[model samples]
Target: MNALAIENLSHSFGTRQVLQNVSFTVAEGRMCILLGRNGAGKTTLFSLITGLYYARTGLVRVFDMAMQANPSAALAQMGVVFQLPTLDLDLTAGENLRYHAALHGLPTKLSKARSREELSRLEVLDRIDDRTCALSGGQRRRVEIARALMHGPRLLLLDEPTTGLDVPGRRALEQHVRDLCRERGIAVLWATHFLEEVAADDDVVVLDRGRVCWAGPADRIAPELGVGSVAEAFALLTGSP
Candidate 1:
């Protein structure tokens, strides 16, 4: 079964309709990159998937569990890193992870061991005991990612995760996420506007004006759009006339 699935999903805020007939799936152990411009309903989709907001219509399934009917179950089977950081700036990185562990009902011993391993894997072990507010943007982002994995979710949802990082920082975080897909076989649904973040082998889904315009392999999009780069391909597909 697919790790994440959505069918004809639609949502709106009063008069403003956001997502319309959105449909997609993320196969187990694969990465799906969600591409869209600003105000394209990326967050809206995330909200629906995570149960922060209910969709006006359609289905959102995570791990074969329906998000609307059983949001807690669906969420427990997944992890999330929102576009905005949710870290407790006043706490140390280790403390932050501990808090997350408790929130997820994880066993203390197991959570601690996993926290140490995750921080090391993300290359932030040296700062585990340091206050989160003392870290740089990239460092904080990494911690948030590590915390997301505390429950060992089968699927990871990241919304504009590389937004504020520099070139190298962005590259590092991207590689880390890809590594998660490769090593742990965790499926990732990465939402972003930057084409550079899309890997040549990754699956691509383009959202334009609250609708999905294209959904296929990244390489396939380049040829279809008559473009050499993903950015240009996106423009060709969703650009203004």
Candidate 2:
């Protein structure tokens, strides 16, 4: 079954339209890449899906649960890591995660256990007692991801997740999330502007100026568009020159 489905989603701020009739689906255990250049409305689309704000027009469903009509239930199954770093610097890694667990109504004992498990899986358990500010950039990112999974969410949404990481950090973070998706049967919507992150078999939706300009398996883009690579095809499809 589809883990996420967006139908005819459009959003606007007064006279400026941010997203125009965008639609897509992400199946369970699949990684769907929301590939768009900056300013293409990637974050805006994420906000809508996460119910930060209702879209001017559209329907968003998570595992067949409609966001508008059953918002709480729908959101409960989703884990999101936005473009910005959201962890409190003053809090220890474990504390931040436990706080999130508390918000989700998880018991204190279970929250601690999950926090430890998640951090361990991400190879950052040693930093659990350390303040978030004391962790390195890569380590902090991993903690944020661990925090997102504390509730065992079935769908994960990451918007520009690797923004400030080095090349190695970026690649490592990408692999970690991919592994999580496969192992947990989690559907993931990873939004990014980096062309190198797009793997050949990845399901990609190319957004341009608030619209979906192209979408399909990454490898198919080149072959079908008569281009040599995903980047070339992306440029052609989005008029990127």
Candidate 3:
């Protein structure tokens, strides 16, 4: 079954339309990059998929379960890391993770075990007791990723996950997430405008002015656009050239 599926999704706020007939599917153990400029409806689509806003004209399905009719079951299979930080600076990394586990109704023992496993995988287990305020930006982001995985979600959704980090930090986080997809078979829908984050084999979804303009493999895009590289293709497709 597909990890995520959206059909004919359209949404509007007040009188301004944000998304129009957006549709896509993410396969298991694959990463699909959502590419769009600012105000291109990427965030609006994410909000609709995550149930932050109801879709007026389309259907969203997670792991073959309808999101509107079975929100809890659909959401149980997914984890999300939003564009903004959601951690409490005053709390330690472990504390923050535990709080999330409690909200998910995870038992204490299982929560601690899963937290330790994920933190270790992210290479931040040693910092578990440190207050999040004391951690560096990269370290805090790692902790957030670990927390997102603590519930054993099958699908991961990340919005601009590498936004503030330096080059090395961004690369590290990307590698870690890629490893998660390969090793654990977790499907990922990573929304970012940064073209460098996409890999040649990754699936690409391009949105322009709240509409989907293209969806295919990264390598195919360059050839389809008569360009030498994905960067060049993106510029041409989006009319940024």
Candidate 4:
């Protein structure tokens, strides 16, 4: 089964519709980039998927379990990193991860081991005892990513995870996520407006005005849009000029 599936998802805040029939699927062990500008409804779509808000229409399935009907099962299979930082500034990195693991019912020993593994993978294991507020933006982001993986989720959802990072930091985080897919076989749905974050081999879903304007391999986008580059194709497809 696909790692995640959204069928005809539509949502509205009062009378203002935010998402209109947005639908897509992320295959297991692959990365699918959700590309859209601000106000393109990416966060709204994510909120629905993560059950922060219920969809007024349509369905969301994680690992073949309906999100609304089987929320626990569905959510247990996914990890999420929101755009804004959610870490406790005063807490140590290890403490933060242990807290998340506990919330997921992980045993103390297992949580510690997992936390060590993930933090080491992200190259933040040395900062495990440091207060989160003392870490740099990139280090904190890495800690967040490690915390998200504490529960061993099969699907990962990252919303603009590289926001506010320098060029090298952004590249490092992006490569780390791609490596997670390659090495750990985790399905990832990464939402971002930056074209450079997308690899040529990546699957892509472009949202324009709260709707999917295109969804396919990144390499195919330019040709399909009759443009010479993905950036130009994106501008053309989204009518951004």
Candidate 5:
């Protein structure tokens, strides 16, 4: 089953169009990478999906439900980690997770149990009591991810999830994310500009100027298109000459 299906989605800000006829399907249990350049309308698209910005036209469905008509229902099954850091700097990771759990209205006992499991899964259990400000960038990101998963969302959305991490950090987080998707069968929509995030067989959607230019498996793209990696493929597909 498709976890997310967007069709003919269009959005605009006054005279400027942000997305036009954007369409794609993210299968259940699959990890789909959304690739685009800065100002390519990735954030705009996510806003629409999350119901932060109503779509001017077209339809967006999450877990097979219309997002516009039932935002709460759709959101209940989805978890999102935005590009920017959202944690409270002074709060410990455990405290941050507890706050998120309360916000979601999960049972306290269940929330604590799930939070512990998630933190361990992300390899941040040891740092659970440490303030977010004191944690490394990658460790903090993991905490954010763990918080997102506390609700056991069926679909996960990440925007620029590995922005500041070093090579090892990025790879570690990638493996963790991959394992989470496979083990939990959660559909993932990972938005990024980096090529390393594009695994050999992963599906990719390339957006340019707010439109989808390509949607297929990473390994199948032309060698020249991907060039050295997926970022290069995105550049080539978007007409970078």
Candidate 6:
């Protein structure tokens, strides 16, 4: 079964419709890139899927559990890292992770063990006791990701996770997340505007102004749009000049 699914999801604020009939799925042990520009309604789509606000129309399912009807069950199976920074700067990385694990009612020993495991996987185990504010941008992002996985959610949702990182940092973090899908069989929906983040093997969903302009394999996007490269296809589909 797919780890995440959306069908005909639409949302609006006042009179402005932000998402129109958005639909997609991320299967187990795979990564799906949600590609869109800054104003392409990617964040809004995340909001709906995460239940920050329920869409008036359509459905969101996590492992066949309806989000609106079975939110607790659906949400329990998911972990999310939003675009904005959410770590408590005063706390150490380990503390932040412990806090999250505690929220999920994990035992102390298990939380510590899992915290180490996740931070180690992200190559930030050495910084475990350091205050979050002192860590570099990349380190913080990695810590946040580790915290998100404290409960071992089947579906991992990341929105602009590499934001504010340098080139090497961004690439390293991206590679780590992709590795998680393979190693842990965690389904991932990674949202990003940067074309370089998409790999040939990934499933791709191109969102433009709240609508999906294309959906297929990463390598297939160019051919499907009749363009020579993914960047060219993005420009053509989104009319980005």
lDDT of each: 0.92, 0.93, 0.91, 0.94, 0.89, 0.93
Residue 209 in candidate 5 has what lDDT?
A: 94
- For candidate 1, give the lDDT: 0.92
Candidate that would win on TM-score: 4
Q: Put down candidate 6 lDDT per residue, 24-132, tens digits, no spaces.
A: 8888888999999998999999888889997789999999999999888988898899999999999999999999999888999999999999999899999999999
lDDT of 5 at 166: 95
- The lDDT leader among the candidates is 4
lDDT of 4 by residue, 113-144 (tens): 99999999999999999999999999999999
RMSD value for candidate 5: 1.9
Task: Tell me the alpha-carbon RMSD of every candidate.
Answer: 1.2, 0.9, 1.0, 0.7, 1.9, 0.9
Poorest 10 consecutive residues by lDDT, candidate 6: 216-225
lDDT of 2 by residue, 147-179 (tens): 999999999999999999999999999999989
Candidate with the larger TM-score of 5 and 6: 6
Better of 4 and 5 by TM-score: 4
The Cα error of candidate 4 at residue 133, in Å, is 0.9
The better candidate by lDDT, 3 or 6, is: 6
Q: What is the lDDT of residue 15 in candidate 1?
A: 86
Q: TM-score for each prediction?
A: 0.97, 0.98, 0.97, 0.99, 0.94, 0.98
- Mind giving the per-residue lDDT tens digits that candidate 5 earns over 26-122? 9999999998888999999999998989986999899789998898999898989988999999999998998999988999899888889999999
Error of 2 at 101 (Å): 0.6
In model 2, what lDDT does residue 108 have? 99
| Residue 20, candidate 2: C-alpha displacement in angstroms | 0.3
Superposed model 3: Cα runs more than 4 Å off = none
Off by over 4 Å in 5: 223-232
